[model samples]
Target: MALLLLFASPLTLAFTLEDLKNQLSQPAVVTGPFIQEKHLRALPQPLQSKGRFVLARDHGLLWLLQTPLRQDYRITAKGIARRDLSGWQTLPSTSAATEQNRLFFAVLQGDSSGLQRDFDLDLTGEPQHWQLRLTPRSLLLKQVFTHIDISGARFVERIELHETQGDRTLLRMPESTSAESLDDAERNDFAE
Candidate 1:
């Protein structure tokens, strides 16, 4: 009976790629307050931090880490930008050296199809709320992240990254909005 019950459990069910594709088809923006909890095996306790995220389609993203320290990251077609109170610095666009960061960009850009080429993707939960588990296929990415779990439905609510070094970072995103339009900013930021 126990064996039968184990085989019948819903947890044993696996999700298909179509399910993930369908979820990404929805058009929406997700802005929110966030908290990042970093846990290192060598540390006594998890280090907590706070932040926010602004996600818009066709435009780009603004990821701001505010708590433990203030930092900002912006990703656009031109490249990735890191900013602080001092100034802003731009990094090369998705290229060979930054494949790991590019993979992250692909995921955030809602291009799961592209991401599928580099990582094994899995999904769980209902339509309203779901969990996306990504396991890196590349040796370099695998060295950094064993797996990445992103939880949320229409909008991402949380992201947990499990690193090969026995460390993890849990990022929680609360529902919110961005007043500034990202498209116009991207255009200006990348003006030639």
Candidate 2:
């Protein structure tokens, strides 16, 4: 019975919110291809876009779209910016956009404490596979999103946004790999 108890101890271990945060935060940089689907209430089909993303723990995210049309976006603490012929042009940050950016950063960076300010987070499953549900706690956030569902194994694999008006946005990072640091090009993009 003592041997059996010892073997079962690992199986009985509970995976908590803090464990999830630590697991996600372990990677300094993650690069992957993504598929984003925007489901509008009035549209018959969702709008799909393919892109590659670079997420750096200390800096920001670089969203480089390759299909349909090529566009590059850099999201940092200041705001969102787009790449053009001249240079990186900062986009106007509406309240909704700003909030969305903050939420995205929080989710990707494993900032559960920061998320608790405006959301009631429900986390489930083990470290290898987990699902997180975020319900809006603030009135402002409640007005825009009904709930947000995020799931992953080690890193964030998918994010689904359920909007108030029956619109939904699905982002899937199907293939992601961790890196020690960003390349020179990615580093330069963040600097700009």
RMSD in Å for candidate 1, one decimal?
A: 5.9
Q: Residue-wise lDDT of candidate 1 within 113-175, one digit each (tens)?
A: 887887898877766677778998988778888999887666566778899988998877766
Taken over the whole model, the C-alpha lDDT of each candidate is: 0.70, 0.92
lDDT of 2 at 121: 93
Candidate 2 residue-wise lDDT, 1-192, digit = tens: 999999999767977778888888888999999999999989999999999999999998999999879999999989999999998999999988888799898998778998899999999888878999999999988998999999999899999999998999999998999999999999999998
- The superposed Cα distance between candidate 2 and the true structure at residue 80, in angstroms, equals 1.3
Give the TM-score comparing model 1 with the true structure, all chains together.
Answer: 0.73
C-alpha TM-scores of all predictions? 0.73, 0.92
lDDT of 2: 0.92
Q: lDDT: which candidate is best?
A: 2
| Candidate 1 clashing pairs, residues 3+ apart or interchain | none
The whole-model C-alpha lDDT of candidate 1 against the native structure comes to 0.70
